[model samples]
Target: MADHEEDDLRMALRMSLQHSPPEAKRSKPRENAGVPTVSASPEESPEVKRRELMAAAAEKRMLMSKSVAASKPEKSADVAVAENSVLIVKDENRVLGGTVSEKPEAVCKEEEMKDVNFGEELPAADANQLFSMIFGNGVSRDILAQWSNQGIRFSSDPETAMGLVQHEGGPCGVLATLQAFVLKYLLFFPDELGKFTPNMPSQNLGSRRLSESECVTSGDFASLTEDGKASALVRSMVEILFLCGSKKRAVIATFSVLCQGAEEQSEDGQKDEIFAKTLEGLPIESASDLQKVLRVNTCTSQMSAFQQLKEMLPVFQSRLGAMLFLISALLSRGLEFVQADRDDPSPPLVTAPFGHASQEIVNLLLCGKAVPNVFDGRMDLGGGMFLKGIPTSVEVGFLTLLEYHNLCKVGQHLKCPKWPIWVVGSESHYTVLFAFDTSVQDENELEQWESQIRKSFDGQDQSGGGGFISVEGLHQVLRETGINLPPEKLDHLCSTGFIVWSEFWQILLELDKSLGGMKDSTGLMGKKQFDLFHFNGIAKSVLNGSQAISGVESPLQRPRLSILRVSVPPRWTPEEFMADIVVPPGPGGNDPSGKDTVVEVTKPEPSQHAPLVDCIRTRWPRSICNWVGDPPSIV
Candidate 1:
């Protein structure tokens, strides 16, 4: 410690003790001083000055210790509690405040006041803000775009649910087809099926029963004989879910009916009849149509009928719920498995059912440790009790799904090389696992692609793939082609625990810049969902009257405010969608401007092909494109 610093500490300690209760006051000469000075001359040698400082510190420490020990326990407790209140001098010669301390030993006392005051004044830091501060813009939009582009409905609506039940080709189609198939299988071969529709709730009964052939090993009527083909069908459905990584078991079961039917034709002509009767005429919906079915009001009578059916259809509800449960279980399990096996990069399973139970399902999925923000949606961290469960399970809670996944970037995942890169990407964007690899050489694979494309183009179609493709063109082509690298390569590429394109470094820089004197007030206590762009708009409105900081950069980029003038084409009615392709009034009479027409024949003869090329040009003079970041580089 410096001589001045020691003197300050001694003085502050004494002043603090003097202010304490009478019994707690230490009886010493000049004990009321707020600083302790060394009894040395101003002309002392450097070494002598140091020795004096050391001696003064020792004397002060001994005096303070003795005073504390002699003080009554209760008084000592009071002093201890207010120890941080001592306004000690800092080494820089500045005095510390009652709410701050210079000595590390006094931090506890200082923190209590700081925390209380901080909480009272500032809102807790939110995950969405933290993520925006770290990553930049468009994370949420990008995610939604990817899912929408890829047709991966998260059961956001009923139309999606119905679509799953009606699809007949791709994975989604297979699920839909399978649903139809399951209905047929049960209706036709009830003898082989058991426990599937074991017993219906009495209120939901439709007064229908299957024939004798539909009852499998019937006894108690609820239990099915495991030895039958229906049992096999059920078992196969489970396997399909595991392999396809689908959480929708009903969809999987429906798919099984179709897949199995391809090979299992009944020699007695029973399966065909059942399939034709049950599946062919069934009214299934698409994802887009699911929302229409969930409406409270109906303009169409059929909608009303379906609504009534929902109440009357016990068999439909039971089968659908069971299938959905199977899907939910698989999704939950799949999440756990993905997290546990560092090597796994399989696609995640998805399930969402309507009503309150969906919230419970979300909770269960989170508890199973699936990252909720795994999609682009922000965690609804504020005010909603239902949202609490969603944020707690993931590594980065209450942030956008993009932010959470970004935290598990290849570098982060491969921190020890033992953990593989986490899987990221949507169906529209090819999902790829990343890892470090020696064979790749360069850290950026994109750079390699650019280089190859450039070289191939320079070589004039000499490359194996043929065609002289430009670097930019190659990127467009690949993105368009939607071809993805193998999972193993992706894992290898991201094995190293370091990131190149990520914005983590930017956050670190911001933190460092704020550490000196300027404290960062942004931090959250719990999870919350947010849209930064929306918030940004709100912030602009709030700061309309605020003074600009001197020499400080504005965090928000100012938008250019302007007015545009649009010119309408001649001869175009205001009501017309296109004004250019209008037919001119025939040789005259009164103008078609609402008068009877009389032929004047002064007009030149109409060209035979004039109608085909009546091209009109419209001006979109006021179009605007909002963008973030620096102006594009010329290069």
Candidate 2:
């Protein structure tokens, strides 16, 4: 019964609880196993004040714990903290900031630790930092190390360092430093740049002194320092020269002696001989050739020699004049040898007269020497210059002097001539040497020989002239043959040796006999036949042969027209007949209706025969007619 009553009461309580509105449930405070609890009142309860003090003490302790924990080495937070109310707690002495706290000492040690880490020799670390700084990576380290092995150091100047960065096996800083060091080092020895300086005295200068005015002055130089540097360099060079021995010094001394001697003597044949001998093997055949050889062989030294010679020339004119002649002589002989040997070794065949000769002749043949070409600046014997196997007038002039003076020997050494005379012709000239044998048997043969030679050289004897043919014969040939050639040209052919006079006149005479004479009856009768013999009448011949009389001006009416008449030769072929035939008179003649009349058809003859004959006639027509018939005054 008691148990039932207990259940009913429990049920009643549950029913009451179920009817109440729901609210968040508060977590139950965990109970401590044996901790004490205190109660407190509002007013003067020591419990309230004590609780407040305890809470304050706990807050202070929490603050102190946080500070000490922060100072200790950090640990995982999950293992240190537990539930909302504290459960297990460490002993206060076991935590940080214990009663015998080492905080001040630890703080001092931390600061001191920094100093120890920084101030100590950490060589390995420092090396790493330096490597990284220079190389960026390890690429350049080996090269730098090699440089360091050689004891090179870095440069402070960035530009110089950068410049050395590009050389193979060269570290940037090291090479610049080395280069700067060398450059600074070189400042102590100033002789390296001496070679580039001007006005350095040649070694020969030790023996020769310059005038005061000619001496080079350092003040005149733009850079006095550079000049001093140059002088130091030159002095060093002089020392080297001195060490090289007196042979070089002797040569310089000799050159100086010669230069000084050149000033004094003014005329040194021996010196010139030495100069000429130097060029003995050279192909110098003239003064010009010698000059050229000198210019080439001496290189730039010749320029100095040239200046010196220029200074000397004016004062030694007489000596120079003789030397110039000697040079010319030497050159001429050399040139002759070269020229003569050009074709073959055989000597040119020479015909000459026999006579007693001089030593020069013997010298020429034995030595194969060419005579020196002498000149006096103007109108001199222009040397023995030969052209077309003959010597020119100027060459002969010199030859005559040697010959007249008996300076040249004949037969033994020099060639002699039979005669001193030169043949002159109307239009040509010839050199003749009469080499006669007095022992010849026939006088006629000798006379014939002389005649033949005279003819060979005679231009005047060539036949064809104005008086050789007759004008009457020319006019007749023109009438006989219609073919025409200009009279002036035909006359020239006869007179200028182009045609024989006899042949020219023969055909013209035949034509004159065949046609009787040319008719002036083509009468505009003002028109005259052109005379082919005259120079001005040439165009008239072509006109007469082809032109219409109606359009032509009358020549007979005008005296000028008469003079313009050209007596040209008629041109006809064998195919054309030469006979008399009737033709109607032209308009205005007696046959007003133009009736047929009998006229000679002589104009169509053999053109070849007539023109050549007319050519002879027109050239010497008077002489020809007089020869054929009763002599006429025309000749």
* Number of the predicted model whose lDDT against the real structure is largest: 1
Model 2 lDDT tens row, 61-114: 455445766797643432333222121111211111111211111111112122
Clashes of each: 45, 32
lDDT of each model, Cα atoms only?
0.26, 0.25
- Tens digit per residue, CA lDDT, model 1, 455-500: 5334433345543333344334335434343445334334553222
For model 2, what is the error of residue 43's alpha carbon versus the real structure, in angstroms, after optimal superposition?
99
**Candidate 1: which stretches are off by over 4 Å?**
1-277, 280-370, 373-424, 427-635
Stretch of 10 with least lDDT, candidate 1: 530-539
lDDT, model 2, position 328: 21
Off by over 4 Å in 2: 1-257, 261-324, 332-635
In TM-score terms, candidate 2 sits at 0.14
**Lowest lDDT 10-mer window, candidate 2?**
250-259
Total backbone collisions, model 1: 45
